[model samples]
Target: AGITGTILILGHTDPLFLRELLEYRITQTVIDKAHGIQLDAAAAQAGQIPEVHLKIDSGMHRLGIDTRQPEDAAAMFALENLNITGIYTHLAATDSIAGEDIAYTRRQIDAFNGLLRTLQGMNIQIPLTHMQNSYGLLNYPDVCCDSVRIGASLYGMGSKEPHKSNVIIDLRPVLSLRARIVMIRTLEKGECFGYGMMFRADRKSRIAILPLGYVEGLPRKLACGRGTALVHGRRVPFAGLVCMDQLALDVTDVPDAKPGDTVTLIGRDGEEEIGIVDVAEAAETLHVEILCRIGQRVATVVIDE
Candidate 1:
C-alpha cells in the first residue's frame, strides 16, 4: 500500500491522462483501489500489518471516505482483512490565505487529525499524514511528509498569484482542437444563418464554414460566446450559430479567404496565440474540462519530446 501510495500521490497530473473513455486507465484507478483493499485484507488476516490511510472528506465534499461519520470511516478501515492506516483530509485553501473559508478548512484539518488521534486511542498503529494540495505545497511545507499529492503544479500552473514560477518546467499541454474550412459562401444583407434563424446578415457577408459542429463537443450552449478562428494568419470570429458538422465565420475581412485553408480553432495562430484555456473561458469552463473533453474522432496527435 505504501508503494502504491507513493506511485499515485507522487504522480503528477501532466502524466495522468484524464480521458474518461480510456477504459484501461479507468480500470487502473479502480484496480489500484481494489488492490489497496486486498492488501489490507491480507494484513488483517495476518494481524502483522502496521497501518494505512483513509482519505477522509471533511468538507469540500468530493472524494475521500467520511471521517466525520465514524461508522463510515470505521467501516472503510475495517475492510474484511486489513489494518487501518492514517486518516487524511483535503483543505479547500490549505494554500490560500483568503478569508473565513480558510477557517472551515482549518477545522477540517483539525477534525481529520483528531480522527487519527481517536483511531490511535483505539490502538491503531496508523502512520503518515496529509492535508495539502499543489498550492499548499508551494505555501506550506508542513504538509510534506512521507508523501503529498501534487496535480497541475507540475504543468506549471503552480500558483494562484501572478509572478509565481518563472522557472521553466518540462510540462506540455496534451490537447489541441482544430478544424478546417470545408466551404465558403457569400451571404447578402438580411440573410439568416444557421438554426433558429437567430443571426441575420446586416450587410453582404462572406462566411467560411469549418467541418466541426456542436455534436463534436464544440459547445453549442455558448450563445454569441464567440469562437476564435484563424484565416490567412489573421483570426476571424464565428459569424453565426454553430451547427453540427459545420460552423460559419465571417471571413470577409480575411485577405485571401478560400476553401481548404487550414484554420486554427484552438492552437497557435501567429504571435497572437489561442489556447484551450482561452476557448474554455469563452465556453464557460476550465482548462481541465476543456482538455478532458476533446471530441472523439478528432486527431490527438501526440508530438513526442
Candidate 2:
C-alpha cells in the first residue's frame, strides 16, 4: 500500500469534472483524447493546466493523435498555456504470442518509441512515457517505458483462458465473493423449482436459497445449472432460473448445509476455490466483465491477513 507515484486520469474529462479535479488539486491528468480545440476549452474553464500526458495513437485507432502525422502531432503538442509532461499510447493486444494482434502490438510499440526519438531530436523532451497495459507489462516489460499501467494484473488476473502467465511477478488473487444461505428445505420428487419451473426434482432434494442474484452480479446461467458454489466444503449445483434477488441451489449433496451457513460464490472454501476466470468461463464472458458486473450495492469487505 506504499504507493508513491502520480495517479493519471485517462480519457477526456468534462470541464466540470476538470474543475472538480482542480478543486481537489488532482492535476496529474492525461489529455489522450482531446484535440487542440477541446484541450483549450476544457483547460481554460478548469484554470491552470496540470502536468499533461499526450496520448498518441500508435495503432489502437481509439484515442490519441497519430504521431506519424507530423503536422497534426506538432500542432497539438505546440498548443499554448498547456504543459506536455509526457506522451503515451495504449497497446491493442499483448495477451497473444503468435497472432496478428501480438505482431501489431510490437509494431505499435515500435512506432511510439520512434516518435519519442523524433521528439528528442527536435529538442522536445517528454519527462515520461507509458504505453504498456497489464498484459503488455507482463509480456513486453522491456518496452514498457517510463511507467506501466497494471490493470487486471493488479487484481491477479493477468492472462486470458487457463488463467496462467509467464510474467516473473508473483501474483495472488485476493478478491472473493461470499453469500449466506437464508433458507434450506427439502423438495419431494417431481416438485418444480424457480421461475418457469425449469428444474424438476428427480428425487428427494435438499435445496438452499441464497439472497444473491444477477442484480448482484451473479451470472443468471447459474440458475440453469451452469455454475456451482461451495457450502460446507462441498459442491452444490444451482437450481432453476436465477431470480432478481435470490437463487436456489441443490444442496442435497452438501448434507451439512443449513440456514445462515456461508456460501462461497467466487472464492476459496476449504480445498475448493472458484476464481474469476472460472465464473467467466461458466458465463461465457471475460474475467474483466465478470468482475465489473458486480453491483455497487454489495459491500466490499477487505481482509488483509
Model 1 / residue 80 / CA error / Å: 2.5
TM-score of 1: 0.68
Q: Tens-digit lDDT track for model 2 on 38-151?
A: 655677766677556778889888877786765555665667656777778888878766667667888998998888888777777667788887878778868848777777
| 10 residues in a row with least lDDT, candidate 1 | 21-30
Mark the regions of model 2 whose C-alpha exceeds 4 Å error after superposition. Answer: 1-5, 27-36, 159-170
* Alpha carbon lDDT of each predicted model: 0.60, 0.77
RMSD of each: 7.3, 2.8
lDDT of 1 at 270: 74
Window of ten residues with lowest summed lDDT in model 2: 27-36
